[model samples]
Target: MMMRPPLVEVRGMTKRFGALTALDDVSLRLAPGAFHAILGENGAGKSTLVKCMMGYHRADAGRLLVDGQEHQVAGPRGAHHLGFGMVYQHFTLVPSMTVAENLILGRDDLPAVVAWAAERERMEAFLRRMPFRVDLDRAAGALAAGEKQKIEILKQLFLGRRVLILDEPTSVLTPDEADQILGVLRTMAREGQVTVVLITHKFREVEAFAHEVTVLRAGRRIGGGHVKDLTRGDLVAMMIPPMLAVEALTVLDDKALTAVRELSLAVGAGEILGVAGVSGNGQRELVETLAGQRSPEAGLIRVAGERYRPTRRQMRRRRVFVLPEEPLSNACVRTMTIAENLAFRNFDEPPIAVTGGFLSRRALHDRGRELIDRFKIRAAGPDASLDTLSGGNVQRTVLARELSQSPKVLVAQNPCAGLDVAATAEIRGRIMAARNAGAAVLFLSEDLDELMELADRIVVMFEGRLVYETARAAADPHVIGHSMASHL
Candidate 1:
């Protein structure tokens, strides 16, 4: 028997952005009609590689071979014409459009003659073949996350794409939703309809669905093999670098309307307390209360030896900082200069402002320059607008400013959410460093793998209650997942 060539292949691929080499001499191959997984930390070149494949970013070097033939794909259209399609983490559907209309988008093959009745029937028939039914006349925008994801796949299949790439497809979905979407993809692959490439951070995703796995670290391929041949530890070791850990600090959050109820836990002074739960499971409320963005309707809060509602002045005086999700909007001012954003905490005091309460530009820039260097922020200079930098750089700026204050309590919500492999590592390292320096860190994330790696102790939030608590050593994904979905 002869071996079939990969449906897609990249050889010696390299991509660079200014002085940064995002991808270097990376290569990968995907077999036809198979479910393959690309695993890496943020900045690990997974997105870069996907971009290269989608023709979003043409490689600076190397060749992209498709079906045993070398071709230079000019852009997304070319990739689409070459039988490739990608479903991003965010939905690309038009909310106003009907399911049938959305599915027909970008199609150049529609007949010149009008036949709305027949087209509707055809669309309905097409949807029937899917594992789940989606009403053709229903508004796409009104659909659930799982439905939208299925629509993405259906659109690809409708377009005759032989290769489908899903980038963190399950990031925003519940466990059951994830299972449903991926289950449909698995069925698609099993039926020899399309080759699937799952780009994700979860090991369980790969174990459950992917037949083969490829690991990338810092722009290079570190490991590749059959999923069965790799152990859970093997994947973890490849993904998580090294980190520092710390002592414990305690927190108690009693009730509210459908939020946390009597949630009391302790995180040491030099420890990372990981909070895990399906989204909307009081994690948001806990984070908000800790950040002082919202006052607890009724509960006692204690941290850094203080027992009271943490006001802005109190939080700043106590050196408590928060790295909220979507830092560009929540943690920063887009119109402001990087220097000004960095000086937000200390703008009224010395080094950033004069004793007479005058804004000192020179002092601020000097301090900003120091932090930019320390945090490896890739900005033109301290004077550059925050809007000009990438997501990772914006996050770095946020971390730089917060950590520079030498905070005693650090509250981070999905700090590494949309970052690449390198940036994620850097942020995690900074969190660990803060812990090592005696900061009590409360880390909340939907990413189980991340929580498992960095946390000294872990807890789960479900229906406004702390349902499960355990040391990191005993934090099993299966157990945590079970507790996450449980109402009791």
Candidate 2:
């Protein structure tokens, strides 16, 4: 009898970032034509482990075997050399470029003229296999989020990728879009196309799509086994959650806190009402409305006893600040220097016009130094591009800039998702500090653990409405879990 070869095998993989240990002797196996899911909590080693597999970060110690042969991948190109491709949470597609341009970015065989014909042929062929259809000539940026994902898929298809690593592929996708992508994945499997390593926090996704599942906690591989053998509760227990530890007696001030926080259309000033739902609930809309970025019909916003609807200018004047769920806010461009972005938020003197009509080098660098030192952000230097910073550091920069605004109401969503342990602790502390400083924090998060741990009062958001606000002590994980699932 002959033994079957595993599609990909990782053994004793370890990665360290100075004092932080992200992956510790972790290992995983992916079989051919299998949909494998990697699960973990917010600060777990899932992201780091996938990084090692993708060849973006080299493992301190590990052996990788593909098709029973050893493989050494130094970077994305090296991984591509070994027939592995990746679809990141954030895409790499150029919004202005057409689909064909993105597909044949670095291939040698397809020359400039031939590239167009070859890409178009390949794009149509791959589109036939996929569930969704996209115009091959359309600019990627104009496509919907789901359609853009199809282009990402086509890029891999053009490269003839065999093993694919998807990092939080559905985070930005709507439910319908998620369904379409998963369907395409299943079609690929039915046709014996490729193997997938899905990195996600969605518990239900594993139960539905995965053939085999691997769960990681902290920086260690805790369990790996058949998916059919586990229950949802079993999976949750495997994640090793931390205790809430909030006592009823911990409340110092509950004057504005109502037993049931009424959240119909109007909420008052100096009210730090919290919104807690499962990760993908429609909390995104409710906050955007109050933040003055999105307009709501038939809704009136009253600030400090003055009644008027929210406007961009009004939100500007009222000091309304919004902290986006994703670490990099639209306000912070990842490519720009840190000081340049930070200067915009500092909001001090008149904007200085320099020799190049850009930010003054010395002024930006000095301000960047102050913010990084003050926030303990990990950065090479003040001049470093924001993209070089880790997810945690980028988040810290955004927090520092927003908090510097000292707003009347802080409307924040998922302020700590994908952050490291130290960063998560630090960012959460800052939000609480903001509340202590008398700024009303409209905290929103899908991680019920975070919402419960940080919020003074919690409101359950299902679909697009605020359902209820349970006191921190009275909240039940099961109940919150049910409400979050209700929207779906």
Candidate 3:
């Protein structure tokens, strides 16, 4: 059988950011009316590739073809005109507006005078044709994450986009919600209504919905083929490369409730083991137990095959460090100066301590200055108050302090939760750097995307127990999500 020409194709596409090559000689063919997935690790240039296709970023070198004809897209608007639209990882709907209002808000041809009645009538027809249902009259903000996402996709379709590019569309959704949305899109693709290109790192979604796959690694097209021709192992082998181990660990919350029950996992040398779950699902308690804020009722904690404790002496001796959540509240003293806070881990034992057991202010400030510069922390100086810094800067301070000693084991909880794009990338880079330097990292986060991006393996924690585990290569987001919600 002859193959249908690609609806969208890129040849030798290359994009560079001064020193870093974001996409390197990457070529992909997105088949018409097919569910195609672009899979890769966080920095594998998945988003960059799609953005280049949409003209969000102009490629330094490459050729873009639509229906076998070469064309240079002027911008996103140009791509939209050519039947291409993208749904970002974050929702774009306006909270205060009704779904109907949001659906028509982005059009270029809106009349100066309002025409709600006719627009509503047209939207009703559009919604009726869609596979999913979302109340048009309801406020967009009042809808759940899944519904909001559906609206985002619907908005594109309503705008008459025939080729849809979804960037991590289901990251915030439940397993069932994700399945429902993907299933509907799969149906749309099968029925020849739309060509779907999914940018994701989840194996389960690819196996279940995608017809063909293109895998990118470190900005290059490393591997790809029909979904049927590849296994989880094959995919994992393409993504690339553990230390902390928790065995039969049990811990209680402040109320004396068993918040953590029989949790067992491991992180090898130079590996990140991501713990995923909804908030209040013993994630906090587990981190607390590991950090020594809470004592475990039972279980063994080891470092490099030796039993370990969270005592200051033991942590220092074992070279273990922690970056707890909410650094300002849980990890730092707000009233203290940046220098003082940075000295907390080693004030008494370091060069910061003088001959008579007194802290040398100069040494402390000097060390603080070094760390501040190294971590790129934005601050007045080492003497500046900790509270005066921004959330991202405070996180930087804590990360700088913990990583200073080049720890043998690191426990981090939502290190980039509220940080901006640049800060998040910097912090994640530091964490990955530590892993590369041979630290056993136990990374805990409620963000599944964060886990999928950084972890070598992931295990879901639910109701105080780890119910599911998978290697990054073999992970099934559906299974992990079900385990997180205790649906399995």
Candidate 4:
């Protein structure tokens, strides 16, 4: 194959935030028409690298070469001029606006915020030209994880981007949704529609979607090569230094843990089943599938001894609720008022009639007030926009609604992921309370210390499969650590 000219080149890129050095002379070359995957653990340099490219952060030392010519991306606007576009894991869109308005949001050509005849017509024209498909009038806040991501991608395409950077784009999507995204990328690559680079910890995605892969560890570029030539083990080893095993959080009697070995375990009605694994395991799949977002191709799901599976209708049932890891993306509607987002989770409700079936606005307001006071949600009021609250507060608001329904099965995926030490403890306590109340809790988390403290039985998931289960007492960090790594 002939070498295509590089689209962007970073040489000796070095950056630091205050006393912490985020990038240690990391360098990467993204070639034209090639899909590149940047792989690393959380807090690694993956996000830092992308931010530097977008001019969100300035590099203390480095040279950026675009089309073989040096360029300084002073800010987001400057990056746009360079034909660079981005779709973040957390989308920024107006929830009340129609999809078409969001697709071309912030364009100066529009006189008013409302979708006019010509603008809507043009948006329709543009939508037909692109691979994105879905209803245009639907509120951005009402869309699912996958559908919302599509709007973000469409935003970039409508801006006439030649290169698109997607950050953890599939983190909240279902397996089928993820496959659809992969197909769209494949089509774009085949037709040379755009140059794409995605940042993720999921190695399988690298193999499925990227032509080349770059591994980073502790702010340094460790390796780069064709994705096909690398195994998941190879990538994991490169991303994290070799070590014997992670220490166990606690100890348990081996013989007493035998009851945990069931291939398929069942928690009685109102019982919360917890599964604790490191971040990026199958938690996303676990919650999403259980919430009816994923349709399992192999295994079976049964509720009350009847085969239960994911469907649009199932999701609307509200039987199972998920408090996703990505709070801003999944838990709350960023731009919508708290009242409006609360309604989105009411899957049990029928569609609004022509006259519009109502959620008693006053009743909802009082209920929101109660939840805010109960959960200590930091929001202005029921009318307050959810975007104004911090991540933890937003998560608490989402939790209020989920726990309100008193779901039969509640899957809280990484409930404490980005919280402070105290906040983590607080959220974990709430989860335990749910379990004590007889709710089946699938507490999927990476915090082993947490699992040791909360879950009666802890399970480890490796590469899309559950590898082992042990009593909380036997939850040695090393065993779980080994299970988390190449042992799978």
Candidate 5:
């Protein structure tokens, strides 16, 4: 018996931008019906490699082969024509269109005449053949994040795409939803229906679903093999390090009186350090100082062992994101569209910003739609003004922006304060997920119960000082309350 040729292959692929080499001589092979995972930190060239394959970017060097034949992919359309499809981190569906309409919307042979009955019949049969089902008549915008993601995959399949590339598909999903989606994909791979290529930073997903893995670092493929052959330590060694520390930090309030005095704390990677306090116990000042709203009077802030300032550039570069107390007043611009507000974080970055510093309105709207679905924010549409959204929806918008970055250091101040029970649960789950993914979380809240439930450690804040500290396992509410009222 002869071995089968790889369904997709890249040899000596390289991409460059100006003086920077985004991808350097990277190679990949995907077997038919196989599940492959690409793991990397930000800027590790994972996106560059995929873009080259999808023809979104013309590689500076190397060859792309589909079914052992070389092909020059001109763009996404060309790639799609070659049976390749990509599900981006953002949804591409038209909100007002029904699921059936969106599924057939991309067809080159779409009919101009009446054919709803025939299309619905065809869609019904298509859903029956799949592992899951979605209501065809339902508007795409009305679907949840997990459901929207499923539609994305189903849309590709409906278009007859045999090879699927998914970029962080589970980033916005809850754990159960993530599991369900990945499980379905895994089963599909096992049944030889499609080949799946996953781009993610999650080792748990890779360990559970992927058969083969490739690790990228600094624009180069560093290590890869069968998933069973690798250990967590092996993958961690290939990646990088991260943490957050504040040493002897001091801040002053509006009267220039000391509000945070000689405060110090460290949040290790994958750890949550909760600051427990009453409303006026220096929590606001500490949060403002961390968020760059107020300058510290003294002391040092460090991220990953390097001196840090919370300038926009530094915050973005270091992956330090914040979810402040009052998102509507502090975070969003009331007059701007939801899409425009969501783009605030990456408006100047690529994909969102085309050449010559012009913003891509389509990209902004697409990203906003994605987050809106994921965060379950009830709104008219991405074009809706921020002021039109309710208080909870506004908070969800801010949560979507900050947590979506997968921050290394998350500075959250009463993130769940005004949210409903369900929304609060969602926000807390996202925060915990971020911490579990190796983020250092600095959580400041007045709710002791919330702190005890989610924090790895707790510290009491009173009169501008951390008066008491204890591991969560050993925390005593009475003791902590006493400390919060009177420094001990």
Candidate 6:
């Protein structure tokens, strides 16, 4: 038997922004009911290509074929009308509205004298049919990220979209929650209920659910193949080249409701120690304590044979740096210029400030220029406001500011949390460089694959305690997952 034509097809898709060609002669054919995955590092054309498909962007050159019929999607609404649905990384639900109300908010086909009671019953039946566990009467804001995500999927399903596009859907979910969400999507695709186009950086997600893979690099299609036909190494080689490894470290956060308890570990010089766990498992408290954002109340932290409190002055004197998660909120003053933000750590002393306590404008700009070039920060200029930069650029600025100090002990908590593949690689590369330069690095993240690749040793955190530890080479995802779930 012959295969049916692709449910969605793009021919010679090309898009350009000024001198940057975001997409060049890109073409894709997504089969009906196939869990198609688009993988690429940051600055790759994955987002661009998807935007074109969703009508959020208009291609400069190309044709989009839906069900063998050429069509131009005018905008997001038009895409929705054309049986294409997209769920963004950030939710679009209204906080005050009930899940049922949020679901039908934008729809206009409802009866003039609407029966909310009957509607609720109908929604309940529909939810039960799909076997979704969301409480329709609850406010959308009150639900967890996973439940809100399910509501988004159900809304799209209710609209009868044949193709569902999810952008980093499980980035915030726990291991168990992520598995459940992806399993549902995979089942839907396998049962011919919908076609899935997942845009993500996690190779594990692709391996777990995707059937076909398309890889892009630097705004062009680099490779494409069936999931079973390729290896994880192949995917990494195409997406992000591996970085150098790091050592082991530990910590205990006192005042724990149930989080950190008697934690003690050590990281070697020129090594990275990776801490992995499900969110809310004492990771936050540990990072806060290590970064000096919170006092440990009681617990000894030793660095290079000296007990330390990780106070700001002690950290600065010791040449230690902390790359806290969400740098925009925690590390930067958005209203300030790029140069000003870069000077935040050292403005009180020379280079940024002179002996007379006067700010050195020239020195600041000069250093900013050097770091922007060295870190490949995409900014208008040092004078540009910090808020004007993109997510990747913001991260680049953070990395440049921290690593330029030549830190002896670097504590980075989810440094690549919201970054793209390229930005993440750059940050990880700098961390490895720090390790190689005799720095003891603490690399903490929820992304297991990242830790496995960048860490020489790994430790799992459960309810604020160190439940499991192993060398990177001997680490197993299943064992780690079990530990994360508090089952070990």
Write candidate 5's Cα lDDT for 115-215 as tens digits: 98988887788888898789888999999999999999999888888788999899989999989999998988888888899999999999999999989
**Overall local distance difference test of candidate 2:** 0.72
Q: Indicate the residue-level lDDT of 197 in model 3.
A: 95
RMSD of 2: 20.7
lDDT of 6 by residue, 1-488 (tens): 11222489989999999999999998889888899999988778898999999999999999999888999888887787778888888888999999888888756365667688887877777776685777778999999988988888888877666788998888878888888988988987887778899999889999999999998877778787999999996786577422221112333445435456667666766778899988878787777777777655456776654577677788788777888888899889999999888877788877678877798899999888888999999999999999999988898898888888898888888988878888888888989998999887888899999999999789988776778999899999899988888746
Q: Compared with the true structure, what per-residue lDDT tens digits does model 4 show for residues 1-488? A: 11222478889998999999999999889878878899999877999998898889999999888888999889888877777888888878899988877877755354655547877787778778778787988999999888888888888777777778889988779989988986797678656777888899987788888999999888989897998898886786687643111111111122322111112444444444456556554556556656665444345555433455546456445366678778788666789888667766652354311135554666556666777888778778878988888877877777777777666666787788777776666677777777777666667777677677777667776545567777676678788778867445
- Candidate 2 per-residue lDDT, tens place, 163-273, comes to 878889999899888877977786675456778888888988888888888988878887868889998866865765311111111111124222222235322334456
lDDT of each: 0.82, 0.72, 0.89, 0.72, 0.88, 0.82
Under the 3 Å rule for N, CA and C atoms, how many clashes does model 4 have? 17
Query: Over all chains combined, what TM-score does candidate 5 have?
Result: 0.52
Candidate with maximal lDDT: 3
Give TM per candidate. 0.50, 0.48, 0.51, 0.48, 0.52, 0.50
lDDT of 3 at 314: 91
User: What local lDDT score does residue 40 receive in model 4, on the 0 to 100 scale?
Assistant: 91
lDDT measured at residue 476 in model 6 versus the true structure, 0 to 100: 93
After superposition, the stretches of candidate 2 with alpha carbons farther than 4 Å from their true spots are 1-6, 106-115, 242-488
Query: How many pairs collide in each candidate, listed in order?
Result: 16, 0, 6, 17, 0, 11
